[model samples]
Target: MRTYFLLCLSIVLAANALSDNLVQAADPAFTHGVASGDPDRESVLLWTRLVSPDSPELELTWELAKDPTMQTILKTGTATARQEHDYCVKVIAADLEPGTTYYYRFRQGNIVSPTGRTRTLPRTAEHIRIGVANCAKYTGGYYHAYDALADTDDLDVIIHLGDYIYENGATRPGDSYYPSFLATGRQHNPPHTCVTLQDYRTRYAQYHQDPELLKLHARYPMIAIWDDHEIAKIPMQKSPSGEPIYDAAWQQRFNDSLQAWHEWIPCRAKQGEVIYRDFQLGSLVNLLMVDTRVCCKSKVDKTEASLKDPNRHIVGDEQLAWLKNSMLTHQATWNIMGNQLLFASKGSDWSRWPGFPTDRNQVIDFLTEHPRINFLITTGNAHNPHHYVVREKESSNILLHEVLPGSISSGNNTEKSRSNPAKLKKLIRAQESNPDLLWYNNDAHGFIVLDLTTQRALVEWYFVTDIRQKQYQVYRAHKLVIDVR
Candidate 1:
């Protein structure tokens, strides 16, 4: 017993020593960068990860200002970074004016983080601009999409649909990878495969260090949701053991990953809970970010009977209930769903709403019933750009307009650059012919910008020529407007 106790003591001491070393280690600059999310009327959530070797969680302070120079201080507070939180800090600055712009920064013992700018929602929004993006595989290419977003001024908020990070372990070949993908650049990285807290935190650190991502985080207030990649690929609640399907270890890893995610990102998850929450951007829009990967069924086979399963669900019963209640109560001009995966699939190999027809019907029914509601869906998975119109069958009017922003770096519309373009074109055509499906781009590297007013909502798609090249070019643009009755 004494021998066992001695071994345990040794392990504890070694851990403490390692932590102390980490705290004392040279701090990584705001590499992956700064970000803001979950904005309320008077406050917004600010995030930053410190790369110090000796201490992961360092005590830090933050300040909010009314202008770019930060000449006038509005709010200031202190926070700490530790191993539990992957050395990240999230601060909520309150008591500010509604629908106003603010600048913020983090300070740790004179090491000042990059200055970030954010805006709070107004009581009534006359004009608002939103940037939407998803599925950025750092290993695939550069983060020029984010850089372009930073350069394009006048954004009210940035919303990420999902797949903020990839879990594919390594970047596949035939891609010009970015510096952020290199092993050395991964300041905090998952070991072997990320099935643990440390793995998730490390993955976040790796992604956050990319300068382009940091710039966007510094430039705008973001509202984000997590897709399958945040935990594992296409995870469903079907297994009591969960997606990866192993008891003790995988469950612990999932819990740890979630805990670390809450620690690193500007999100509010009360331990073991899912990342399903809602945010209001003044009176202009209601953003409901939902997690469909958890407690849900994976994609079913292509059999007609399976595809028509009445029991399968994507958002599950509880979330669907919450969504119904929320949609009924929403008074905004535009009801935006920050969805993670494509609600309408274009025959991709992945699992999406098509695999769960019953729930899809219910959701469509709800949208149809709420005829007065103008809805927009933003999503990340599919790694391709898609615009679909969910129509109210009886009225023949558009009910929901979905914008699937292509990944900053992920899959493309092309099938290995070898498949018949005509077939893909046919699929695209079918989707567009639907009254609800307006425009879709499966091949591109970019984000979406939405400009909304009380009367109408205008959406613009921004495409980058190539993310593999350090220098990117803009290739395409599309705009759509929805008028609210």
Candidate 2:
């Protein structure tokens, strides 16, 4: 018994000594980890941040490898991490083979960043699987959905619709509606609502520090777009009365948010250009990501005159023209529209595409006319799962399918509905009013797994059992198949 006790004491002392050394050696460098995104056939964007408090600028080296060990280097280059860009570095690794997975890492001195894995879009693929997610509030719950997705090795890519980071502050200590106890214990870095560029950057940093999200980024390539929360609530650039709403300060705020987004997100867009771009996945999918917030018209009231206004547009003319051209010319098996707003016509919801009835009608008409085109619209910001069929107005024929993957960690509609029974009843009435709504669930938090082939596209909604707990099971809450061929 004495010998066993001494052995345990020695082991504990050794562990304590090792932990002390690790703590002493720990410095704030590469604090956010590494991420890769915006993958093309022969190129991918790599991102990393060097959090060097003592240095304003630091030279970093990045290498791309074909193996996880990084012994076989395919490409290497040097980048500078400056304080102006928040010490973030992004570089495009070009001239790579299509459909090939690559490993990447960043190094500065003896410190090495985490290795990230990314794959380019295939020139020809018989099938593709993508994970769709959005609306991850830092104070909402645990990022169990992201952890599950990281473990899901079959996913080719991740499509993030919007609300990647909420601008809201930490949840109050003792709020009944959003109790702090129910939160995942992750708080916003600023401890207040984000209003400045620094605040937004800090919020993003807090989100990036999440282990599950970091793991997801390290494993799969992500294509993301920002919704309202990244800038402001409601994202009203103009008032309802046709006056410019964003003042000079607010405009500056918007610009700062844009800069931070561009710096942090590995999007392949030049400065001052819009983020709406098209990606081709062999002959299987033509993914068109649209930016609906930046250049959108003012949010109008639900008046008939406002809805019928010819000038009101959801997607600006340039993006709309690009979308039309892509739709008309694409020969892929699936035309996937990665949108930020809810595409369905909610009776009085002026925040969505329904507010711009003219543009909405034009898109609907285009889809109706092109019956052979397999159109699939994946949208976010609803915080709940919504599967609906977009039908023609006159003939009531199905034009396409709209799939809304529930939020990653945001509060579900069920909780809100429970708090307000009348609102829930009204939502049910709205669903009943629309025959195009195939199914709707407002009580779950999860993501959608989209599997596509030459013949059809299958969408499976996976719901996390509990977001408050780190360990949770994802159950297939819903599944739908659309004949694409």
TM-score of each: 0.83, 0.91
Cα lDDT listed for each candidate = 0.69, 0.80
> On residues 1-485, what C-alpha lDDT tens digit does candidate 2 reach at each position?
11211111122112222322322344547777678888999999999888777778999999998777688998999999998998889998999999888889888988777777788999998888889989988787888888777666567789899899888876774542265235456666798888888998988877877777877788889998878888777565555444667679887888888788887887878557888988888889999998878765566666777777677777856677888799788778898999988787666668688777777877887777777888899999889999988777887777789999888887776665665789888888888788878998877888999999999999999888988877799889889998864
State the TM-score for model 2. 0.91
**In candidate 1, what are the lDDT values of residues 336-378, reduced to their tens digit?**
8888767864555236775676777788888777778777887
lDDT of 2: 0.80
Q: After TM-score superposition, what is the CA distance of residue 376 in candidate 1 from its true location, in Å?
A: 1.9
Query: How displaced is residue 399 in candidate 2, in Å?
Result: 0.6
How does residue 405 of candidate 2 score in lDDT?
89
In model 1, which range of ten residues has the least summed lDDT?
1-10
